[model samples]
Target: MKGKLLIFLIILILTTVPAIGADISGNVISESGKLAGLIVDLSKINGTESDENSITGVTYDFIPVASTVTGYEGEFVFENLDNGEYRVNVTYEGVTSGENIRLQDDTFVEFNLSGTIDGYVFKYNSTIDGVPVYLYDFYGIPAGNTTSGNNGTYSFGNIAAGKNYFVSAVYAEVSYTNNVTAPASSDFIVYDTTDKSDNIGVTIDHIVLSKDANSILVYEYIQFINNGDRVFFSPERTWLAIPTPRDISNFQTDVMECCLEREEDTAWIDPMIPLMPGETYSTEISYRFNPTSEPVFFNRITMYNTDYISILSEKINGLGLESTFSESNIVNVNDKEFEVLDFMNIPAGMTPDVKITGFVPSKNTGSDLGILLPLLLLLSAGALSYPFVRKKMLLKKKKVFTVKYNPDNPSGENGVPSGGNSEITALGINAENHTSGKTVEEMSFHELLAERNNLFESIMGLENEFNSGNVSEQEYMAQKKERRDSAVLVIKQLKDTATNLDLTQPVPELEEVIRHIDDIDILEKLFEREEKGMDRNEVKELIEDRIEDIERSE
Candidate 1:
C-alpha cells in the first residue's frame, strides 16, 4: 500500500504540473516567425474577454505561480514555471492588426499572435550598458526585458503565442553629451518573419543611439520579425564614469499626442504597441535632455517608467509594457563593456581624470633627436671606427696638391684678379671651408689706429710746404690738392674703423692749433697761403714733422 501510494503521488505531481519547468518557447505571429517585446495585458485585450472579469476567449496560462514573458528579436519564453491552464489576453501597445491567431494552453504553441516578429532593444542614443528593457500592452504597464550582452544583444524567452505587446528599450544610468538637447531614439518591438517585415531571423539589426547621436526630428523606429524562432537573444549596453547612479532625472521620456488622434495615437500613452512580426513602427517620446551647471559630473544609470501607452480617439487597445530585460551591461569611455551591478545613482565630480601633460620631447622620446643624433653619431662613428681609413680618405680624396701651382700664372698681388680663369690653383695656404664661417683670430683696435696716424702725417707735410711759399701758386694748389685727397681717404678709413669699434661717443674739442689731416678741406686751407715757393715734397716733409710732434704729445 505504501509503494502504491508513493507511485500514485508521483503520478499526480507529474500530471498536475502543467509546465515541467522546461522553457516552452512560444511565438506570437501571423504567418511569420516570433513576436517579441509586446506587452499582453491580463485585464485589457481586444477580441479577448477583458472588459468582463474573465479571459475566456483567449488562452489562460495558469502556472502554479503565474509568470510573464518578454520578446527580443521577435522571440519570447517563460522559464521556471510550473505551467497550468490560465487565461492570457494579448495586447500590443499600438499594433492591433494581425492575420494569424493562437489559442492558449500551458505548453509551447506556434500560432498567429498577430503579425510575426523579431525584435531588439537598442539604447536610445546611448552606448551605455545594463539598461533595463520594458514591454507594454495597449495600456501602459511592465511586460518583460531582454538581457543585453556586451555585443548589445538581448533576448525574450518563452511567450504566449498570440500575445501582442509593445516594447520600450531603456538604458539606465546612461550619459548624455554636454550641451546637446535632442531626442536620440532606439527601439524594442515585436517582429515577424515574413517578406513584409523589416527585421527577421536570428540576426536582428538595430541602430544604437548615443550621447552624440543626432536623430531625425520626425521619428525613429524599432523593427520586429516573427520568424517562428524560440527565445532568440539580443544584447544591450550602458555606460557610466562612476558607480551607477540612481538619479532618474537624466532618463525621462515625454509623450506628446499628435493632432491626428484617429487611431492608436493619444495623450499619456507610450507609442510602442502590439508589434506584428516583420512590421516596423516608431513612436516619438519627447527626448529633450536638461543639462546641469556642474562640472565633470556623472550620469546615474537606472530603469524608469517601465510602463507606457498608445491610445485611440474614443478608447481602443493597442500595445502595453513589460520589464524582463537583464540588467547586466554597461559602456565606458573606451566603448568597452563591463558587467553592471544594479541601476543606481552615480554622483557628480566623478569623470575620468586625464592629466594635461606638457611632454617637452625628450632625447629618448624622439624630440631633439633630429637636431643632435645623426650628425654626432656620424662624427663619433667616423672617429671611432676606421679612423685610419677616414684619414686616408680625407688626405687622398681631398686633392692634396692638385698638380702644382704654376708660377707662370700672373700673381694678382697689387692688381685685383678680374677674370674667372685667373684662379687655376692655390699655392702656399688656401682657406679651409669652415661650417662656423671665416673669422680672423685677432686684430687690435689700437694697432689699426696707429696705421691711420702715419697716413695723416704724410698729408700734413705736403700742406706745410705749400703754406711756406716754397712752391708756385699752381704747384702749391696741385700739391695741396693731392695731400688733401690723401688725408680725406685716410680720415674715411679712420671713420670706418671707429664705427666698427663703436666709438661714436661724445668727444671734447681741442683748441691749440693742432694740425689735423681730417679731409681735403683741412689740407688745402693750410697750403692756400698764396705762395709759389712751397713745393709738394717740402709740404709733405712739414706734414711728417707735424705728425711726429702730434704722436709724441699723445
Candidate 2:
C-alpha cells in the first residue's frame, strides 16, 4: 500500500508540470550584408481580462523569457517556446531591432535589417559631442534618434533604405536640419549651426527712425561677431529671424553684406561667407509705414538687445510727436531734439519695445508745398556741399602713416598704411649719420623703422598667401623664418641704439615692434609642429593649447 501511494504522488507531480511547445529560428542580416552577432531575446506576451478600473488602449510589456546569441551566419534559434505570441528582439552594435512572432508550431523567421544613417554635428568648424540628433521619415514620423559621440559623430540604424528622410540636430534650444536619402549601406550628412547665437556672437549697434514726407522710415544696424576660434563658414546659409512691425507693402528688407529673405513679418538673413574669428558682420534693414492724421503710435520691435538705439525726425515739430525709449538719452540733431538710446552692456536675448507717438499728415491733409520748398532746397544744398566740406577737412588734416611698428591690424593690410590719400614719399632717417649704407650699430632711428616695416610687410604677405591657399605651409614657414630672423636682428639693433644713446624709459616708436616680435617668437614655437603638415584636429588641438597658454599668462 505504501509503494502504490508513493507512485501515485509522483505521477500527479509529473502531470501538473507544463511541457515545452514550438521552436523558432531566424537569420538577421543588415542591408549592407553584414552578419549580426548579437543577443536575440524572446518575451512571452499574455492577454489580460478587462477590468472596470483599468485603462484602455494601453500596452504592457512582460519580462523576457529566453535569449540567445546569433551565430556566424547571423542565425538565431529558440527551442521549446510556448504556443503563443512572443516579442523577438535583436540588439547589435548599440542598435536594437525587434518584431512579433506567433509560435503556433516550429517556425522559421527571416529579418532583413534596414540601412543606417551616420554623420557629425559641427559648430564653428568643430565637433559638438553629446548633442541629440533626430531622424524623421518623409511623413514626419520619428524613425530613430541618437546622441553624438565625443568626436561629434552619430549614427542611426535599422532605417529603411531608398527612403527620403530628414536629420535634425538640437543644441541650446536651437535646431538645424538637412534632408537626405538612405543608401544601401548608410546615408552620411552634416548639420551645422555655426550662425546661431551660441556659435556666433551678436550685438545691436543702433536703430534709427527718421521721418519721411509721406511715411516714416526705420533703419536698423546690427552687428554679428564671430567669437569662435575658427572661421564661421556659410554665412548666407545661416538663418536669423527678424520680425518686422509693418505690413508687407510697407516693409522693405535690405540685406547688407549678407543674404536676406522675407516671409510675412519675419526676415531671414544669411551672410553667405566665412566669418573668421574677431570678424564683424554688419547688417542694415529699412522699412516705411504711413501715418494717420490723428495721434498714431509707432512701435519698433527690438529683435535683439541693442547696445545703442536712437530716433530722429527732421519734422519733429511739424509731426507733433514725442519719441520715447527705455533707458535712453535726449540729443539734438540738426536743431531737433531726438531720443538717443544707449545701453552700456545689454544682456543677450533681451528684446525691449520702443514706442513713438506723433500726429502724421494723413491722406486728408493738404500739401505744404510752401514749407517743403525751403526744406528741399536745404537738403539739395547740403548734398551738393558735402564733397567740398569733406575735401577741406581732408586738406587740413595731417598725413598719418599706419605702418608704425605695431601688431597685425587684422584687416589683412599687413603693415601697409591705409586711410591717408597722400602720396608715398621717403622721409628723413632719424640717425645722426644719414648714409645710404651703414652697419647696425650706426643705423638711425628712421632706418630701423623702415627695416622693421619691410619685415612686417613680408610676413603679412606670406600669411596672406597661406590664407588664400596659394602658398603651402612648408613654403610659408621657410619664408617666415627668414623674415623672423631679419626682424629679430633689427629689434636687437634698435635696443642697442637706445641703450647706447642712454635713453630713459621705453622707446615710444619701438615699443610696439618689441611687443610684436615677442608674439611672433611664441607663434613660431607653436607652429613648429605644423611645418610637417598636421590635420585639422591636430591644428585645433594646437590652437586650444595656445589659448590655454594665453589664459595662464593673463
Candidate 3:
C-alpha cells in the first residue's frame, strides 16, 4: 500500500507543473529622433498576419501564432514550442522587410528590420552654389541632396527607410543645415517624389539661398604644395612651450613643428621625415590663423619655401627637423658650443621652413690651419722628432704593459729566489749541482759560522731598507721576508752542521740564487703557455711554488 501511494503522488506532481513562455518587446524610431506609430503583424506561413497598434511606447508581449509565438511591436517570440526553423518579416503598413528565425525547442526568438536608402542628385545646370535640398518624413527620417557648387554636384548620406516622405530645396543656404525650419518653409518647394518605393534613385528637390542685403559671401583658401610657399609659413604646432615666449602678441603667424607620435611611453619622433621624389624633403605648415599685418617670418625655421597659411587641426610643439639643407656641418662629433639667434622665435601665427646653407664655426680656424700649414710644420719638426715622440709614447704604454714586465725589477729576466741553494752549495756539498766549484757537505764549524754571519748582515741590510720606505711596499716586504726567512733557517742549519764555534763562516753568497729566481726569460716562456690574465691568487701561488722548488733543490 505504501509503494502504490508514492507512485500515485509522483505522477500527480508531474502533470501539475506550470508551463513557461518567452517575452519580447521593442520600438520603431526614425533617424530624426521622433516617435513612430507602427503596425506589427505576427504570422506563421500560410496564416494571415494579426495586426496590433504599436503607437504606444512601441512595446508588446509574446503571443501565440499557430503553434509558435511571435512579437507584436518589432518584438516577437516563441513560448513553448519544439525546435524548428521559422521565418518572420517585419512591416509597417504594407511595406514588409527582412526576417528572423526560431531554431530550437524552448528557445526565445526576436528580430526587426527597415530599408535604408541614400544617393546623390546632380543638376544639369550650374548657376548657383551652396543650396540645400532635403526630404522629411512623418516618421522623422530626413535625407535628400543639396546643390553642387558651380560644378553641379550634390550628395546625401545616412538615409533611412519605411514611411511617407516629402522633398524640398532651398537656394543660397548655409552648408550642412540639418535644422529644417523657417527658411525651408519659405524658400523650399515640396514635391511628391515617392510614396511606397523602398529603393529609389536620387531625386532633384529645388530650393533657394537668400543673402542679407548687408552681407557678402566670404571666400577663404590658399593653394600650394606639400611644403609651404614664399608668402606663408609652417605654423607652430603649439602656442608656446618651455624656453619660449608666453605671449605671441609681438609676432604675426603661428609657429609649428612636425613629428610622429608614438603610443607607448607617450613619445614622439620629429623628423619622422621622408625624402620626396625630387630628393628634396617636403614639410607642411598647416595652421588655422586670422589675418595678420606684419609679414610672417621663417627666421627660426629652415627649409626655404613658405606661402599663404593653410589650416589643419593636428600639430606638435617646437621641434625643428633637419633635412638635406647642405652637405656641410660646422659642428663635429664633440662640439657643444651653439647659440640661438634672437630672430629664432616665430610670431603668433606664422609658420615656414627656411633653408640655411654654409654652417659657421665660432672657434678660431685651427683645423683649417692644420690642413694648410701641414707641410711647413712637418719641415720644421723633421723625421728625427718621430723617435723622441715615439719614445715618450712607449714610456706611456709601459704602465699598462705590466703583464710583460714587473716594474719593480724590469732589469731581471727571473723573479727573486729563496736562497737556500746558495747556503747549501757554499758548504761544499756535492748535492749533484756539480757546475759550481764547492764539493763537501761536512763543513767545519768555522766555515759555517762565517757564512751565517754573512747571511745575517745581508738580512739586516734588507730589513733596514724596508723600514726606510725607499722601495715600494710590495718590493720591500718581499725582499725583507725572503732574506729573514733564509737567514734564520740557514743560521740554525749552519750551527748544527758546524765543527767549531770559534771559526768564522763565509758569507752566504745568494747573488746567484737571486739572479736565477729573477730570470724574466724563463717567466716569459711560462706565461706564453699560461692564460693571458693571471689573477692575484694565481700569481701568488705560482711565485710561492717556484720559490719552494728552488729551496728544495738546496
Whose lDDT is greatest here? 2
- Models 1 onward score TM values of 0.16, 0.30, 0.17
Model 1 lDDT tens row, 240-272 = 011122211222122233311221111122222
Candidate 2 ranges beyond 4 A from true positions? 1-195, 228-230, 248-258, 291-295, 315-328, 332-337, 347-349, 361-554
Winner by lDDT between candidate 3 and candidate 1: 1
**Model 3 lDDT vs. the true structure?**
0.28
Among these predicted structures, which one has the highest TM-score?
A: 2
- 404-433 in candidate 3: lDDT tens per residue? 233555433222212221111111111110
- Spell out the clash pairs found in candidate 2: 235-271, 236-270, 236-271, 236-272
Off by more than 4 A, model 1:
1-126, 139-142, 157-163, 172-554
Which scores higher on lDDT, 1 or 2?
Answer: 2
Question: Candidate 1 vs candidate 3: which has greater TM-score?
Answer: 3
Q: Between 2 and 3, whose TM-score is larger?
A: 2
Q: Model 3: runs farther than 4 Å from truth?
A: 1-4, 15-37, 45-82, 93-95, 105-115, 120-554
lDDT (C-alpha, whole model) for all candidates = 0.29, 0.51, 0.28
| Residue 67 displacement in candidate 3 (angstroms) | 14
